[model samples]
Target: MSKNTLINILFLGSILFIMKLTIFPQESLGIGSDSGGINLVPFRTSGYIFLHETFIKFIINILGNIILFLPFGLFLTMRFKKINRLWKCIVFGSIFSISIEIVQLSIPNRWTDVDDVILNTLGTAIGYAIYKIIDKKKMYLQED
Candidate 1:
């Protein structure tokens, strides 16, 4: 009913979504690319390994990485007026991605990738852009 209540709900939803993306089983989902050459195989692998994995899988992986952080940027900017800056959301996304990668290093069967960080940052930027656009539209409409 209140703005704070909505913010809290969004915050919880964001955290749950993030956990779903980052948490993986100790056993390998075997999503790795064995064919090699240019695939979305984590950090060191070549893009050739793309064939080992399906095109749809690759697309989902990339898009999933992006969408995973979208709410983070949106909800963060919405909840914290002070952190509503575009740069701040970008930084937060970067840090969050890096943190996931680092934590993955300690986890079994998880490989950290630079691509995730880049994709996540892009997602955060996009979310912030959406927020800004909507925010501007709201202000414009309110001018009446």
Candidate 2:
């Protein structure tokens, strides 16, 4: 969109990136305690549906993760208009998530989860989709 919007997005993105990095610092040597190591816990859809605790946990986990990096995707798309394309947005988002994962793998007290990568990418994609929808609405209103 506009230069002012891009600038604002960049400013926000920088703040978010710094905050996230600070909260989840990278490992010192690319490996950390076994207790905090990455775990490939499969999301149990049945548990999500059947058990009250599992259902609440699943909802919380999904929503929390989705909300975390939403700003990253939003700012990325808003700053780089070229990222409006779905494939480009996804690629950049995936790379960004991967970088965060790699950093987490190195840091102590932080565990690198593949599920986080997936959820983060999904958040990015959802942000892009939201932007697209908003843009389209603006265009339609303008035309009308």
Candidate 1 lDDT by residue in tens digits, 13-123: 997777655755522434322221222454443243355767877777678778888888888788878887889989988998888778766665565777778888888
Residue 144 Cα positional deviation in candidate 1, in Å, after optimal superposition: 1.8
Candidate 2, lDDT over the whole model: 0.68
Q: Candidate 2 lDDT, tens digit per residue, 1-144? A: 988777686748754763455345445522232346665564443244346556666775676667666767777787787776878878887787777777776666776676767777788788788878888999999998
How many pairs of residues collide in each model? Answer: 13, 3
Models 1 onward score TM values of: 0.80, 0.72
Error of 1 at 126 (Å): 0.9
Runs in model 1 deviating more than 4 A are 26-52
Model 2 poorest ten-residue lDDT run: 25-34
How does candidate 1 fare on TM-score? 0.80
